[model samples]
Target: MSTPSGNGDQTRRDIQQTRAELGETVAALTAKTDVKTRARTKATTAVGGLRGRVTEAGQSAKTRATQLARTVSQKASQRVTSVRQKSQHTVGAIQGSAKASAQTAGKAESSVVTSARAMSTRIGSSVRTKPLPVLAVTGAAATLAVITYRRRRFR
Candidate 1:
């Protein structure tokens, strides 16, 4: 049978019923507290295991990184030392080459000076013998070269 109650009274009754159900549910949960505890314990153990694995992985990575860094540093140092030795040898070779070139240049200069003086003496003797003919020939050659250069330039 439907109760003849106002809407506000019906709402209060529904609220009271929900509160009673909630009380019973709380009692049931209280009784199963041990089960909840066990579930929580299992979850805690799983999380601890994951934490251990993560810590171990981090440590392993750190050790490997340190080893790789050391190896790279050692190799780089060795390469630098090798390059330094090679540069030293190259510098020594360049110095030796420069010294040899200087000596050769000095010898060539001395030879040129001696040859120039000897040629000057020979020219003086030749001028005494046939000065006029040599001067005329030189003038003719110079004029011919100048005329040829002008013709080529115009063309």
Candidate 2:
């Protein structure tokens, strides 16, 4: 069987619990009614998110720029090396050509010198052996040159 005292005690406990729940509901309503505070909170949260995105984007751009710089630097170095190699090859070719030309000139010069010496010896011997014939030939050569010159001048 139920006792009247037990029932009364249970009713008081229920009333107290209902009052506590009502107070919590009123506090929640008051907080919702505070428009300025709610707006500030929302704006603060939005600004925090925007800052995070901005930071990430800035870092990404910086990384891309660094990569581009490195690429440009590497390409420039490669171009320099290529030009250096080509110039070296060209210089080597020129040096070889110069050496060959010098050798050919030396040979030609020596040949000319030898021919001149032989001609000088022959002319000396001929002059010693036949002075009269040499003088007559020289006089004839001079006369022929003067006649050829006069013809050209008159023309």
Best by TM-score: 2
Regions of model 1 farther than 4 Å from truth: 1-35, 106-155
lDDT of 2: 0.69
Q: Candidate 1's C-alpha lDDT?
A: 0.67
Clashing pairs in 1: none
**Highest lDDT scorer:** 2
Error of 2 at 74 (Å): 1.5
Question: What is the C-alpha lDDT profile of model 1 across 81-106, one tens digit per residue?
Answer: 66467557655655565566557775
Badly placed stretches (over 4 Å) of model 2 are 1-8, 102-155
